[model samples]
Target: MSQNNAIYKGFKVSAKVRQAPDAFPGGDVVHPRFLATVTITQVSTGMGSQRLLPPEIQQFADAPHAAITLALTSAREAIDGMSTFVKAK
Candidate 1:
């Protein structure tokens, strides 16, 4: 397959418990509290020759900054939805 025809393989979304406070029962604390963290990483094959993408794709090849920005924005939107649901309870 041509290099440009390769799909982005996709990215990884990771989450860690940053902070979780334990519940206190009577005068003793049973569970401990900890903080939570979430991170996202994009994974893709290295850039190939410009000929790989269609003419349209070639246009953005020079603008990696914009591409990354768009990716982050999308990721943020997805994370926001999850956060809202978690907070609802």
Candidate 2:
């Protein structure tokens, strides 16, 4: 997926999509399934940040672009939430 990289609240958000077999058999015709992964890292330190979201299984989609969009949205929301917590302290 293109435009998979984003910067949010001083952190870098990188998104990638991977193909995975469907848990349940798809009788007759099988369709491709994709999982989107989002990685957040500190731009200043280049260190990996903790995942604010849950497992990739919850972010799966039938279409690659939809999966990527979901990943990007989740990543940005996580960054925003983290920043808000830091400022609260």
Query: lDDT winner among the candidates?
Result: 2
lDDT, each prediction: 0.34, 0.68
In terms of lDDT, the poorest run of 10 residues in model 1 is: 53-62
State the lDDT of candidate 2 residue by residue for 5-75, as single tens digits: 77777777788887757656645455788888888776653344343433332367888889888888887
Scored by TM-score, the top model is 2
- lDDT, residue 33, model 1: 39
Output the TM-score of candidate 2: 0.65
Kindly report which residue stretches of model 1 are placed more than 4 angstroms away from their true locations once superposed: 1-62, 83-89
- Tell me the tens digit of each residue's lDDT in model 1 across 1-89: 01111122343443333233355555666544343233444443234211121111111111334433443444455534432222222
Clashing residue pair totals per candidate (backbone < 3 A)? 14, 0
TM per candidate: 0.28, 0.65
